[model samples]
Target: MPPPASSQSCAPAPAPAYRGRFAPSPTGDLHPGSLMAALGSWLLARGAGGEWLVRIEDLDPPREVPGAADRQLAALRAFGLHPDGPVVRQSERGDLYRRALDRLLADGHAFECHCSRADLAATGGIHRRCVATTRRPRPAVRLRVAPDARVAFEDLVRGPQVQDVGATVGDFVLLRADGYWAYQLAVVVDDAAQGITDVVRGADLLDSTGRQILLQRALGLPVTRHAHLPLVTGADGRKLSKSESARPVDPTDPLPALRRAWAALGQDPAALAGADRVTDLLPAARTAFRPQLIGRGDTAS
Candidate 1:
């Protein structure tokens, strides 16, 4: 059964003057890598005199850790990154996703896909066309990507970006066969519903930007400004993610982690050197943050 709706409704609301968000999944405790994303997004929003909201991307139940969402929120508060509005959880927004799927199906932008991973493995995992010989009771739904489908956008940090979505990823899934809402669909819908004006996240999600842009155009949703910060990587040059058991940040002593994340974003170290509290550190960091100074590539945590 779907979870009950959160305190806030998923219905589209009047666009805010300027809005940004830091959405985190409840797969584990807040780690240094995730902290960088949160801090980066918060700094961008506050620096621009915009509202920064928090959204819990708790859509995958099987992978979620119990109590992780509350812990993540508590840690953000400890770091003095408070949301301007009530926090929202994606698990409670099923109705919104369903409505989006219905619209896509009705318009012929999306179709039922019976292809499995194995069925498309020979084509490098790109779902170009249906290859399933036998149809399954539950089929994934995918957005139809045209042969000439292309998306081009200017990223605040990375500059000019372009992707041929049809050739690169083919017709991507909107609803998985496992009966779970795909991240691409949920994020695009929620961003529009929340009236997000800018999307500031890690560079790791850069590839997803084009796909999301396509979704925005297909749904007639406003395309938000994007800035992808440098990712925090481990000694092995791999991204330090929750799935890899990255060490969790200590909310009890947030200054050190906060400082590290600030440096990871390529801001000057002296900007937050004297800060002994999160309250003082955040304002100083926000004032000194320059998106142009943020470098591309992996930042060792």
Candidate 2:
């Protein structure tokens, strides 16, 4: 593995350099919504001629089904989304995560807390309470956010935005009460660890981007280009979820889904009518992968 990002790592990490990855948590079968994200992220990295990696976000194995990650990979293969590097599994990197967490805790960037869902709700969501109350460690680790500090970053798709992460997201958790690695800490370390210079994912993760940026800043790691695509909601106007029993993506027939996703993104799938297979569709997308070409309105799955 390459060396982890340190004080000597490049500032802002040069564009069209380093790598990008699609880290999917295998809670269930891949769905249309999931495929859109994979396609978008894959195209983003490929268009840049950079390395593309795949990672199974299986840190929370309790939530992971027995064969879900492999099944997800099978779907990606069927859809022709191949990675340039070996796939990484979060479950296999526990030591790395533990080291990162310990560093954050020792540096005063994180602390131990026993706040439960109800304990946090009682204080209007962990805001202002962390400053006044000192709770003993029962099971979780919470990051320390300066109450007045603001985290600002630019989005390639959504443009410039600013958030007082400390106030808005509150002092977030790094390790959950159940001992699972929190998405915030895991993703931050993983991005730097993976040498990702660009992060292209669904827009629903926009809020989390600020927190990731904060963690990067704290660690002195380089910031990457962040682009959050328009969310793919369901017909019911809700986020399409595997838990809600969203229709499983048919890996055998990725064509229909690809066409539908293009339409959903407001792109003209018929523009390349002769595209009959995965290889043909990918080339078409790479040639026509203009972010501005994506329609401006919201679309539900």
Candidate 3:
């Protein structure tokens, strides 16, 4: 077996470099909505003269597509969104997450629970009751949340934000009974591992930011600044999802989708409409990119 990861390896990376990342799950192809997230994060990093990276969130094997990771990378390249460093995949970094979980358990910040979804739902959608119990075949690890753990942060685009994770989410899971690492734990660990200083993604995940911040504090990791851009919804007013049959961006002719994505972020596309390729369009977009330009509410463009 390989050597176990040390505490240093799991801790937040030292700062000074302005690092940002675009992490996407490989459950399906890169749709227009996904492209918007990719573009927003890319522009923010590149515009700040910082390094931009990509990490494939391929931890959930059951929902992952067979060849989606490669396809997603190819699409990003076709759209002229290249990373500054080598790509990282969550599936290959299990040891790091395991080490972090061990630390949390050893520090008495986390515990094992066997509560099922039905059980949590009956308890007002929280695992508070089962936090101290360790009964059952395959138990999940949950973090002990303090009732007054109210986290607040300034969002670059949306202004001030605050949420009481302990009151709302309550002793969230770190690892599932099925043995897959929960997103809250993996995301916090990876953001620190990648030295991410800014998190630019769609507003759909804004609610979960509080939980992430709480986890970061529990792990003594640095909390990254967040900028949640407007989400692109369908005709039904629902945010676009790959699982719901949202069409993926056309790899051969990504210009149209790119233009739409640019506009969806509240940037004017007329300035770059004459450009033929993503390479020709990014320079001007980077010059004008700012999260504040994106308006509030779901964008239908």
Off by over 4 Å in 1: 1-12, 242-245
Clashes of 3: 0
Q: 40 in model 1: Cα distance from truth in Å?
A: 0.7
lDDT of 1: 0.88
TM-score of model 3 vs. true structure: 0.93
Instruction: Please provide, for model 2 over 223-284, each residue's C-alpha lDDT reduced to its tens digit, 9 standing for 90 to 100.
Output: 87887777677777776763353688898899988877777665677665789988898899
Q: Tens digit of lDDT per residue, candidate 3, span 1-301?
A: 1233333377776654578889999988888889999999988888778989899998899999999999999999999999988888888788899999999999999998887776676668776767333467888999999877789999988899989887888889899999999998999998998789999988989988999998898899988899998888876667887235478899889888988998998887777867886788888788767666787777874
Query: How far out, in Å, is residue 118 in model 1?
Result: 1.3
> What digit string (tens of lDDT, one per residue) describes model 1 on residues 13-121?
5777679999999988899999999999988888788999999999899999999999999999999999988898888888889888888899999999999888998
Give each model a TM-score: 0.95, 0.89, 0.93
lDDT (0 to 1) per candidate: 0.88, 0.76, 0.85
The TM-score leader among the candidates is 1
Candidate 1 lDDT trough over 10 residues, lowest sum: 1-10
Indicate whether candidate 2 or candidate 3 has the larger lDDT.
3
- Candidate 1: give its CA RMSD in angstroms: 2.3
Write the candidate numbers in order of decreasing TM-score: 1, 3, 2
- Identify the leading candidate in terms of lDDT: 1
